[model samples]
Target: MLTIEQATYDAIVAHAKRDHPDEACGIVAGPEGSDRPERFVEMVNAAGSPTFYEFDSTDLLHLYQEMDRADEEPVVIYHSHTATEAYPSRTDIGLAMEPNAHYVLVSTREHGNNDGPVEFRSYRIVEGEVTEEPVSVVDAFPR
Candidate 1:
């Protein structure tokens, strides 16, 4: 299961809604080896396609370097799908490189940009295998 704060979840959904029609991608970083998602880092979708999402190579490199220096790791990697369900595509499964990170997919097909329901789901993609997971939104993480 992926447990996250409500504010973090809302921020991700907002970013996805803001970038509707084009996939929104980002990451939530936490302390190294920590599964808790504490920091939201919205990213540019290099692909800029409704059906696809790719982090900008330059931005990804810099982000990784910064994370390393800060002793942080990406606990959640997320993207939005404009027209599809909140599920990973074949390409997404093929590109799963973070076995330890939660892969989140948010679908804005039902509501587009207006105020309506969206499909927000989490998954674990490891070595081309996809496993859907449960999500729990809380007010905050315990100290």
Candidate 2:
């Protein structure tokens, strides 16, 4: 299961809704080897396509460098589906490079930019295999 803070979850949903019609993509970074997702970093969708999303090469490089300096690693890699369910596509499966990261998919098809709830799902993709995981939202992380 992927446990996340309520505020972080809300922010991700907001970002997805804000980028409706174009898939939104970003990541949450935490200390290396730690599964905690404590920092949210919103990223631009280089592809800017409703059916696809990509991070700008330079931006991706910079993000990795910055994370390295902070001794952080991406704990969550997320994207939104504008027209489909919150499930990984073949393309997504092929692009799963972080075996230890939680892959989050949010579908804005049902609600679009409305106030209605979206379909939020998480999965673990490793070596072309996708395994669904449960999500737990909490007020905050315990020390």
Candidate 3:
């Protein structure tokens, strides 16, 4: 299961909603080798397409460099689906290079930019294989 804090979850949903018709993409970073998602970093989608998302090469490089300095790794890779279900597309699966990261998909189809619940789901994509996983949202992580 992918365990995330309620605040982080809310922020992710909000970002998804704010993006509206375009797909919102981001990554949550945590200590290296740790599965906990601690830092939420919203990213600009270079593709700017409702059906696709791409991280700008320069921005991605900067993020990685910063993460390296902080001894952090991307624990969660997320994107919003404006029109489809909260599931990974073939392209998403193909592009997933992080073997240990949780891939999250949020669907805003039911209430585009409105006040309503969205379909938030998590998955594990490794080597082109996709596996749906359960999510646990808590107030905070235990110290």
True-structure RMSD, every candidate: 0.7, 0.6, 0.6
Candidate 3 per-residue lDDT, tens place, 49-135, comes to 999999999999999999999999999999999999999999999999999999999999999889999999999999999999999
Error of 1 at 77 (Å): 0.4
Task: Kindly list the per-residue Cα lDDT of model 2 for residues 14-117, writing each as its tens digit.
Answer: 99999998999999999999899999999999998999999999999999999999999999999999999999999999999999999999999998988999
Full ranking by lDDT:
2, 3, 1
lDDT of 1 at 28: 99
Q: For residue 45, give model 2's deviation from the true position in Å.
A: 0.3
Overall lDDT per candidate, in order of appearance: 0.95, 0.97, 0.96
* TM-scores of all predicted structures: 0.98, 0.99, 0.98
- Global fold similarity of model 1 (TM-score): 0.98
Model 3: pairs clashing at backbone N, Cα or C within 3 Å: none
Cα lDDT of candidate 3 equals 0.96
Off by over 4 Å in 1: none
